[model samples]
Structure formats: C-alpha cells, structure tokens
Target: MVQDSPATRARILAAAVEEFSAHGLAGARIDRIAEAAVANKSSIYVYFGNKEKLFAAAMDRVIGDLSDAVPLTEHDLPNYAGRMFDYVVDHPEALRMSMWRHLERPSAGPVVTELYERKLEAMASEAHPSGLPPMDLLVLVVGLSGAWLTSSRDLLAAEGGDPYSAERLATHRAAMVEAARRVVDGV
Candidate 1:
C-alpha cells in the first residue's frame, strides 16, 4: 500500500482540474498535470490510471464540493444561487471544464453519470413541488446556472455594473429565487 499525503492528492486534483478545464479530456496533457502538481507523470498514472480517469475524478470532486455548497431545499434557492455564483467566481475553471464536457460529448463513464444522477436526484428531492414535474424544476435550476455562466460578462458590463459585487449578486440571487418561486407557486 502506497502512502499518499492528503495535501499531495489535493495538489494533484487541483492540477488535474486546471489542465482538464483548459483542455477537454481529449486535449489535456498528462505532462501538464504532472508539471502543475509537481508530481511525476508516472505517479499520476499510478494514482489515477489515465487522463480520462483523472479528468473524471477531478470533475467529481468539483461537483461534490459544489453540491455540498448549494443545498437543495426550496428555502435555500436564493442562497444556493448565490453560492453557485460565488463558486463560478472563485472557480472559473470548473465552468470552463463543464462547457468543454458539454461541447465534446465525451463518453458518459460511471463517475460522470453517477455524479450527474446524484445531482438530479438531489434536485428532484429538494425542489419537488406539489404540482410541478421534477424535470421542470431540474431544468429551471440548470437553466439558471447556464444563464449565469453564459451572460456573466454582459451582466457585469451593465451600467452601474459589477456583476460580482456582493450587493448586486445578492439582488440577482433574490430575483432568481423569486422567479422560481413564482413559477413553482403557479402565480
């Protein structure tokens, strides 16, 4: 059994996220991940097996972290959106990685599907309204994230702007939640 420090694993994961985000699984290079991690390429292969596995693991870690950060309860919608926005602001790489994955349409390996299903289940459980279909809620949540990521620059450029400013973010968060509530409430 090889002993690996948590810090070392974290470094490797961080490096993997960066590399994968910049270049999809197809374009990402193991050498770059090794260089960024300060770990030998052989070590990455030994630990993660291959670039595909490493990319999946890195994405899984990020998704898990994000799920933890954004609770799914209806009461948590605004806060959840805010946290998501905060996450994108802090980890733009994650967003880039996601976009790349969507664009590439890579094979849905176990790790990818499992994490995605978990998120869908969580979203269904949390946003399950009395009359609304679970899929609708799912779409709403996913759409919100998509809109934020896609329109972030435009939002930031608006007059009196500062999309990432705390106050503006809070306002946007509240508005999004209210919009969701209105739809869910059938108002």
Candidate 2:
C-alpha cells in the first residue's frame, strides 16, 4: 500500500474532482481516481471511507477553493458577480462538479451549508435596500453570474463566434455584472 499523506490526499481529491465532473458520482470509479492520483485504491478508502464520502470531500474542496479564490464582496455585488464569472470561465470543471452534485446528491454538505449561510448573513447585514430578500438577491446574483457559462450551446453559438472566446466572455461578464447591479440596486 502507498503511504498516505496530505499531498496524497490532495492528489486524490483533485483527481476525484476531474472524475466526478466528467462521470458524476454514480459513474465515477475508484480505480480511475486512484490511478489518476498515482495512489492506490486503499488510500482513497482509508482517507475518505467510500466513494460517496470522497465525492463530498471533493465538493467541499472545490467549493472551498472557489470561496478562497473569490471571497464574497457583498458590498460590491456587481464586482462579485464579475469575479465569479471569471472564476467559472477559468475553471469550468468546478462548476460541472457542482452541477453533478446538485443532480446526484441533491443535498448540501456541511461545508456548502456553512459557506452559503455565511454569504446570506453577510448580505443580510448589508445596508443596501434591494427589493428582494437577501437569499433571493444572492440567488439572483449567482444565477446571473453563471448564466452565460451554463446556457445552451444554441444560445451561445447564436453570435456565430466561439462562445468562450475572450471577446465574448468579456461581453457576457459585463452583462452579468450589470444585471447583478440592477438586481441589487432595484433599478
């Protein structure tokens, strides 16, 4: 058995993210994750107990990374939306893994719950007088931020250019930020 360490654990989680993003929790294979991580299957089981737990851990890790990368700026919702759009554009797999969890798990784990609660609290504490409640505002902002990236291919290809090209991404990011501003500003 390969020795277990923090590095090995991190590798497993990273590989698991890729696997789960591609195949989802139901279709993800432990052997493939272990092989991708250059670790053994026993290490994964020892570290995460089972495939489901591993998926949870992977989700937590990716969400944590996103939070760290783009700490919520509730005070500047538009900038926050733009930053989120940038993050997702750079790391689409993270969003894919999150979508898989939503479909297969359908329950927020502790880390996700805590992070979401924190964001809600922050939004509630903000002095802005948006018409919508904090939870709804947050949802609106998040939805607007990810819309371009998650939209159907037909909609994306409507412009007859690479939807993910730099120019198109900038345009979408600008529109998302403006939408967030309007939603938060109640305009």
Candidate 3:
C-alpha cells in the first residue's frame, strides 16, 4: 500500500467527481478513477471506505463549491435564481452530479439536509408577496434556476442554432428570473 497523502486524496476526489458525474454512483468504476487520478485503486477504498462513501464525498465537494459560489438570497429569489443559472453555466458538471445524485441516491445526506434547512430558515424569516410557504418558494426558485439546463437538448436545439450560445443563455436567464419573480411576487 502506498503511503497516504493529502495530494493523492485531492487527486482521487477530483477524479471521482468526473467519474461519478459521467456514470453516477452505480456505474462509476474505481479502476477508471484510479487511472485518472494516477493512484492505486485501493487508495480510493482506503480513503472513502467504498463506492457509496466516495460518491458522497464527491457530492459534498461539488455542493460546497456551489453554495459558496451562489448563496441563497431569501429576500430576492429572482436575483438568486439568476445567479444560480450563471453558476450552472460555468460549472455544468455540478449540475450533472446533482442530477445523478437525485437519480441514484435520492436521500439527502446530513450536510445536504443541514444546508437545505438553513436555506429554509432564511426563507421563512422573510415574507413574500405570493405568501407561499418557504419550502414551496425555495423549490420553485431552484427549479426555475435549473430548468434550462435540465431541458432536453433536442428540444432546445429545435428552437435555433446553438441553444447554449451567449445570446440564448442570456435570454433564458432573463426568462428564468422573470418566472421566479412571478412566483415570489405573484405578479
């Protein structure tokens, strides 16, 4: 066994993110991850215990970066949604990992639950024009934020050339923000 080191751990985490995002937890291969990370396959098991734990660690890293990049703004959900759209555009892998998590591991881990609870508390502390419950508003805003990304590529392509072009992205971002505003303000 190779001596454990922080650098090897970091490489493993990075490789795991790419692997899990592309194949999900069930389909991900530790051999591929080890090759990508230039570490022994056994290192992953040593560091993360198993595939499930490794997936969780990879999600934690992605979620940590996402939350740090785009925090929840309870009072201005529209702007918050816009920011989320922007973040997803920059880090599409994060979205893919999240989708995979929902598909294969539907339950929220403690850290994810804690983060969600914090957002719920923040939303409940404020009153919106729509008067919808905090959880409902949060779900709506988040859904709108990622709606474009989750849309079928064929559907988007049918609209025009390069659905992900700068112009299209700007247009979708504006629409998503407006939809979020309508939900929050009932306008």
Candidate 4:
C-alpha cells in the first residue's frame, strides 16, 4: 500500500504549484514535480491519481487559501481589492497559477465555482447593494486587482518608469483599489 503522509503530500503540493505556475498543465512534468517534491512518482499517483488531478488539487488549495486571504466583507470593497493587490504582490505565483488555469484548464473545480456563487449571493444580500449584476462585482474586482501583474510592461512603458520602482507599485495598487471601489459603488 502507498501510505501518503501529510508532509509528503504538502511537499508535492508545494512543488506542483511551482511547476504548474511555471509551465502550466501541458508543460508540467511528473518527474520534475517528484524531484522537486522529493516524493516518488507512484506516491504522487496514489495521492492525486494523475497530473490533472494533482493540478486540480493544487488549484483547489489556491482558491481555498485565497478565500481565507481575502474573505468577503460588509465594509469597503476597495479595501478588499487593495488587499488582493497586496496579496498578489507577495504571491505572484498565485496569479500565474490562475492565468495558467484559465488558459489551459477547460474547466475547474465546483468548489471554486461555488466560491464565486457564494460571493455573488453575498453581494445580492448586501443591504446597500452595489446594484451590479450577478458575478460582475467579483469579475471586476479580480480583473482590477490583477491588471497590474498582467499589464506591468505596458503600464511601465506608458508611465515612462521602472516596473520595479516602489512608487510605481504603490501607484498601481492604488489604482486597482480605486477601480474596484468605483465598480462596487456603481449602479
């Protein structure tokens, strides 16, 4: 029997996240993941069934972590977008993973779908509702939050500045927050 320990599983997950983020689903290799994780290939199979399943599991973890990292709030949504930008700044791999998922994954977990649904339901229940349509707020917030990472090159060139400049990063984050706030505050 292939007894998978929590430690081993975690290592595999960590390695898988890096691998998938770097290479997406098609380019990711089981051997590379196994080597980086220091776990056997059979163990990976036993734990996650296959590379696709491993990818799913890793993405599931990412969404779950994001849910915790940026929980929905009754107060300022701009703050929420700011928080997301801050998070992405620190965890760019999450953004890469999301990009890869969107591009390479034809479908994703119901858990992520349900998470979005829950957010939509929450927005629907807001007392001072933004009046945005279903999932629009969520979509807008995500797009605004990630725009910096996706558009750094263009933004840098347009702004005539270094991408890594602290001022530029702060400015980008502020814009993301303001954009989200506008969307949420809009009808």
Steric clash pairs (candidate 2) = none
Q: What is the C-alpha lDDT of each candidate?
A: 0.68, 0.85, 0.88, 0.79
Give the backbone clash total of model 3: 0
**In candidate 4, what are the lDDT values of residues 1-187, reduced to their tens digit?**
3555998989999999889888989999999999999998988998899999999888877766776897766356788778888887888777887888789885753355665677677667766457767466666777787787888576558867587577888987877787777777775
Better of 1 and 3 by lDDT: 3
Candidates 2 and 4: which is better by TM-score?
A: 2
Q: What is the Cα-based TM-score of model 2?
A: 0.88
In the range 6-112, model 3's lDDT, one tens digit per residue, is: 98999999999999988988899999999999999998998899989998899989878998899887788899999999999999988998898788886633366
- Clashing pairs for predicted structure model 4, backbone only: none
Which candidate should be chosen as best, given TM-score against the real structure? 3
Model 1 segments more than 4 A misplaced = 1-7, 74-82, 105-131, 152-160
Candidate 2 lDDT, 15-119, residue by residue in tens: 999998899998999999999999989989989999989988888877778888998877788898899889988998778877887889866443556777887
- Cα displacement (angstroms), candidate 2, residue 72, comes to 1.7
Least accurate stretch of 10 residues (summed lDDT) in model 4?
Answer: 106-115
Worst 10 residues of 2 by lDDT: 106-115
**Candidate 3 ranges with C-alpha deviation above 4 Å:** 1-4, 108-115, 118-122
Q: lDDT of candidate 1 vs native?
A: 0.68
Q: Give lDDT tens digits, candidate 1, residues 48-110.
A: 887777887877776666667655554445445556666776778757766776777444222
